[model samples]
Target: MWTKYSTLRATLKLHENADISQYGRLIAFLKNGSKNHKPKKAKVLEREHIQQFLVEAPNTKFSMMKVALLFGV
Candidate 1:
């Protein structure tokens, strides 16, 4: 059974996809959402990717690479 637990889930939804059904569900799910939240997925970074991102990254602190991956470079 692959049923979703509507009770224990956090109410954090975004209008990422333009689908009507998805957008409506997202609205219901995040109707009572909080400000502080974290995404479930973790970004994976390779040395090669970082090297490429560094070239186009702006500023020393917030670079394109840093924003690209949710994690660190």
Candidate 2:
């Protein structure tokens, strides 16, 4: 049986090599869209998909601005 602590420990170990800010950004993105909706599963993002996202994303939003800065596009 998987306990909450065990799950968290496993997840931390799994992502220990990953950038911590990326994790924070992902969690924030999930929380932002999770209101009155089910969260979607994670998948690898493709360049085309990201480009589409950037194009459709509102320019006035801070998150999109950060994304633009991060991707330099």
Using lDDT, give the best candidate's number.
Answer: 2
Off by over 4 Å in 1: 1-43, 60-73
lDDT of 2 at 64: 58
lDDT of 2 by residue, 1-68 (tens): 12443566567768885333347665676567656675589998798877776777777775757576
RMSD list, candidates in order: 14.0, 14.5
| lDDT (Cα, 0-100) at 27 in candidate 1 | 58
lDDT of each: 0.52, 0.64
Q: Candidate 2 regions off by >4 Å?
A: 5-41, 62-65, 68-73
Worst 10 residues of 2 by lDDT: 1-10
* Model 1 Cα shift for residue 40 (angstroms): 9.0
lDDT of 1: 0.52
lDDT of 1 by residue, 1-73 (tens): 0023342232222333233344566656665453445558988878888777666666686665466664654
